[model samples]
Target: MTPTDPFPRVFIGFDPREDVAVNVLTDSMQRHASAPVQIAQIRLSQLRSVYTRPHNPLQSTEFSFSRFLVPWLCGYEGWALFIDADMLCLGDLAELWALRDDRYAVQVVKHQHDCESGTKFQGMPQTPYRRKNWSSVMLFNCGRCKALTPQVVNTASGLELHQFQWLEDGEIGELPPQWNVLVGVQDVPEDARILHYTLGGPWFDDCQTMPRSELWTQARQALNHPLALQASS
Candidate 1:
């Protein structure tokens, strides 16, 4: 499908528990985006009608399964980007938006993530699965991803959706790892485009010491600065 909007559409997964994370992420994206972006929050509260799946124990966030509805939400046309609210955009989002390719159903940073068995933010179980963290950041070619209809997203198992079972191996395109750099878990580079606080971000008291967490702190400070607030007003 052809894009109707000139700007990129970004849908961020928002969990009420991490309100600050989402706000900081949005501010960071706007600060760094070269062009205006259509950003929307995929909060489960607003999607109860479309997403009627029973809660799974392993589900860590409100948008865990709701994120799959990105294609359906776009009316199965054009393209859109979905990202976790816990991320902090460090580079221009236009660069990531430009990487969108219609030839594939979706593009993602395919991380070989094997998180240790334990707990994460809010003491959620740190369950690991195949293609872990892949769904955290996705470039969805909506038209080609017709298989992710609302019905499918509501009923499919966690693995079926996260592992891209609906699409062939070739349909899953790869993005540069830097685009979804895993904080704490990976040796983050100085120029990481997107920082994924997969384990937990500095927002939590316990995660204040996580590597590279100072970046998030700086972003939060910049977001609330008097000058920044005055400029936005």
Candidate 2:
């Protein structure tokens, strides 16, 4: 979890409903990463002991609030990346990992997302708030993010956490928007490194037609068809 850490540690939010999404995402990351990466899924069911907060009605995904636990999970030391399950890596993750900055407590793609209020995948309400999708992807400088203890994460209001009230404004660094291109929400960019299916993904019947969904389908196909190994003398 430090600069000396052998591989970049990535913690992905996991929701049981989108199990396939996480699998495909992992496959995409593994295929594109220039070096080995350590990935973990943050499942609420597995953290019953540490995260005991009652579910909030507005919670869209199981990892809504649990995403804040990334720093604490890293033992409040080193650097790590946290991303939503509904994402695909189109470019090498090593490129994204190289952008980590130590000056900020956390780095994210600062988005001014003003999407209309409506329902998203699986009938989830699309609520709007300040710094809406920023938390969806994070590069945590865990050493500087000591403020996010387990108690703070579990007890803090959604706004306080999502808006990053735990740290000063200057401490919140920014990443390029292309790293978290929102499908159907943000304009499709030719160099989008990570495609975020924040609204929904092709895995769901209704979201099958989302922009660049074919890319996700292709990744899934690649996941299912592993390269065959040839026998050697």
lDDT of each: 0.90, 0.91
Clashes of 2: 0
Q: Each model's TM-score, in the order given? A: 0.94, 0.94
Tens digit of lDDT per residue, candidate 2, span 120-170? Answer: 998998989999999999999898988888898889999999999999999
Model 1 earns a TM-score of 0.94
Clashes of each: 0, 0
- In model 1, which residue pairs have backbone atoms overlapping below 3 Å? none
